[model samples]
Target chain A: MSSSEMTSPEETPLLEVRELSISFGGLQALNQVSFAVEEGEIFGLIGPNGAGKTTLFNCVSGLIQATSGVIHYEGQPLDGLPIHARSLVGIARTFQNLNLFHGLTVLENLMVPVEVRQRRGFIADAFRATRSRFGESQAREEAGAILHLLHLGDLRDVMAGELPVGLQRRVELGRAVAQRPRLLLLDEPASGLDGRETAELGALLPRIARQLSVTIVLVDHDMALVMRVCDRICALDFGQVIAMGTPAEVRNDPTVMSAYLGASGAVQVAQR
Target chain B: MRFDRQLLVRAAMVIGAFDVLYLLADHVGANYRRLMTLSAVDGLLVLSLVVLTGFVGQISFVQAELNGFGGLLAGAMIGRLHWSFWVALPLAVVASVAVGIVVGVPALRLRGLILGVVTIALALAFDAWVFSLDTFKAQFIDRPSLLGWDLSDDRATFAFCLAVLAGCAWMVANLQRSKTGRMLASIRDAEVAARTSGVDVTRAKLLAFGISAGLAGLAGVLLDLTIGTADKQSFTLLISLNIAAVVILMGPNRVASAFAGGIFLRWGSEILDKVGVGGKYLNVVLGVGLIVQLIAAPEGVVGQFSHIRAAAGRSLRRRVAAT
Candidate 1:
């Protein structure tokens, strides 16, 4: 069931998650967390390990099912749709772990989702979908556009695995952008990068969101990158939403501070 | 990133080089020609495996069984129904593609070793079911004809197989550059990443299976045409094992390793038999070669070539600068 307060937002939130919960066996990963990401906004989902950040991502992307909740995208419910369907609806995401095919070239990596987006829907499959000659040309054009945007047009021929860690993340990002998504969910885009790489990511990310008109839901542990890129932040502790506000508000909140450093530890750390 | 004039020229140059090679090979000795034909057939099968295993990252051990479906269908249509080879061949391909979809639906749900086990079972089942039926054996003993021409002759069969192999290669090469190829590659690398990136894992897997199975079916039709009969004994489980081995042996960049593996199989057998040992010894050698290739050249021979070329390019550039 959706929250009654979901109607409060007038701009028609790009992604609306209400009371979403998920669990593996008996261990609950996400617990009744409600939030809405506005269109073209950089939204952050932050938490300690096992705080259900990735789990929530999995739910919205349709990789994992929500045990109880409603997730709406563009006013349509995204509860039972498979992962690819969510992708077709302009919802794209990356992984917490690097998920690039080492064997393929960087260019090949970017072409994948663009091809999917170029595919005609289920009706096309049933009625000689491939017979439509427009599909192939469109796919090629879209794929080329994505690769060019990522500045990976040069590395297109190079094997994806051989690239450095920073480049791989960009490749992953490029792959997502290729899908032409309205909402992009990035799971720890700055996980293994150094300060410079992270800063480069910081500069590149906003341009991507602005140019592509994509709303971002980034799940990260890096406060610096998150604070820099994210317009708003949602803090989770133990599967529950403990704080949600602007970066400054969430940064100074007592619950968020305590959640990061224990109840008494926050004061001690502050004093030091 | 820009598709410049130089890139187009390079692509044309590569295609032109192949044409020259193709012309040169046309005048070679019969034995070499036969090996080439076998290589072509092998390449077709290997190309299928590359799409399924290498590109899609689904380890399928049942490609031989899928080929068997093509060979058997061709035999049944030609011998029993008196159908033309052209008609029978496409019929076989369609049937194989259907089987691929059916099997893929179940197999795709299971990943890693589980998917491997399930597909292997399908391959084993194809072998056992065909060999066990006397009616199938008796009724299906016939030559596969193409365009009303009985294609039992070796020379004609070689030409036909070579043409089909080239066509198959072209299709695969185009796909490798296409968006579908990228999607499968991404899915193979990381399904979660691909899925979140808006790629549908299941559909991509299914398409990969279909492409691979279609190629296998095409190869099977060519095989039956060469042998003049469709015997269940011809497409052994070992063929599946060998194809998988070939993929591993060739590594990733060498999509053409399928052809190389075929040539190796043809030459390696004769060399082994000429040494006074029987043809059975070839499998042992193949097993060893497969193991060595997996260990020594897991990137396959093509990967090694690229590596050497890169190193040579670097050295040459340095020398030129110094001069």
Candidate 2:
């Protein structure tokens, strides 16, 4: 179902998850997770390892189905949709592990999502695709624009696999943005970057959010970057939300502090 | 959609280059000319494999058999039913495409050795099925006249087949530059990522299969046209294996590379004979070559050429900068 057919855009958040829970075999991964992201907000999801942060992102993106609960995008339920289908509903995601199409050129990597979104059909692609017929495809122009936005115009012809990790991360982000998603889910955008690269990414993320007018839900281990840029932050521990509020509130919350530092020893650290 | 001047110039250049080659083809002896014709036809079959195996990362050993369907069906239509060549051509293509899609259904769920086995089974079935049809037995077929010109002459038929191969090459190259081109390339690398990127993985695979099969079918029809018969021996599982080997050996990267591979596979033995080293030892040498190819150049010979060219270009650029 389309967002236009939804009940009301104003009434519903861009993304809403209610009591989301999942498990692999018997191990409880996510339990009663709930949150709502407002339109055009830079939302951060932070948790320690095994806290089901990636699992939660997977559930929302349609790679992993939650055992129970609902995921709504612009008031439309996205729980039953496939991963690719979620992209059509304006939800695009970057992987915690970079999944760029390495065989393709940098420009072609960005063009892939744009082409997939805009392609008519196989027959059209073979005989009448505007690019083949006219020599300059709209996909190229769109991809070129993304390269410019990502400041990757110089490396457009380079193979994606040959690029540096920081540049590759940026290319992956560029690819996700090329989908023109309204609700972008970034799984550790700062994962493999150096301090300088992380700082550059931190600066770029908010610009992407404001310029594209997109609602972003970024999950990362980098606490400083999340704290600096996020409008709101949600902390998860053992698949349960310990705190959800403005970045200051979540960071200062005692439960979040205890969850990260351990309840018994954390108080002692504070005492000292 | 403005008409591009560079595109037109490129098109002219491609055609001009082919015509020059075609003129040289007119001078070769009948045997070599005929062998090259078969090579071009084989190249078409190899081209199909490139799309499936190289681009989509699917294996098929039935490409030659698919070509046989075009050859034998069109052959039977013209030879037994007395239908016109032009009329049977399109019907044969569609029928082979249908067969391709049917074969592709199993491929959707199967991959690697299982997929390879499935294709081998299909190829064997095709051989047996064609052998059972009495009317489909080896029969003389005539090439049709195009635009009031008779194609009964060997050189004329060879020229026509080359033209078709060139067209197919152009189409394949064009498809690569299209949106679907990137989709297949993505499918080749990370299929799951392609799916999440909004690529309908199933449809894309089938499209690759169908298109590849269609090209093979066309090549099969051309094979019959060039040889003057719908020979059952041409579409055997052995032929399919050879075509598969050719694609792998050539490293299915470029249309030019595939065409060159086809020439090598089809006429390599003949060329070897001309050089006075043709016998049982040839197969041994080929086995060694294949082993070397796998280890030394997984991308195929064309891949090596491109690598060398790239290295040369880098050095040249460096020298230019120094100057």
| Model 2 C-alpha lDDT per residue in residues B127-194, reported as the tens digit of each score | 88855588677778877898887899888888888888888887787677677788899988877678
- Deviation from native of the Cα of residue A272 in model 1, angstroms: 13
After superposition, candidate 1 runs with Cα above 4 Å error: A1-9, A120-156, A262-272, B1-39, B138-153, B276-278, B309-323
Give the alpha carbon lDDT tens digit for every residue of B148-209 in model 1: 66555555667677767766766676566555666677787777777766676778788878
Position B165, candidate 1: lDDT: 78
Query: How does each model score on lDDT?
Result: 0.76, 0.83
Error of 1 at B89 (Å): 1.9
Tell me what fraction of the real C-alpha contacts between chains A and B each candidate also makes.
Answer: 0.65, 0.63
lDDT of 2 by residue, A1-272 (tens): 00111224457788888899998999999999888888888989988888999999888878888999988888888866877788777888888888889999999988888877763666665665654444336778888988898889999999999998889889989988988999888999898899988998889889999999888999987788888889988888888888888767776777878787854424432443
Clashing pairs in 1: A93-B196, A112-B183, A153-B1, B250-B300
Instruction: Provide TM-scores for the models.
Output: 0.85, 0.90
Clashes of each: 4, 0
CAPRI-wise, candidate 1 is acceptable
DockQ for each model = 0.42, 0.51
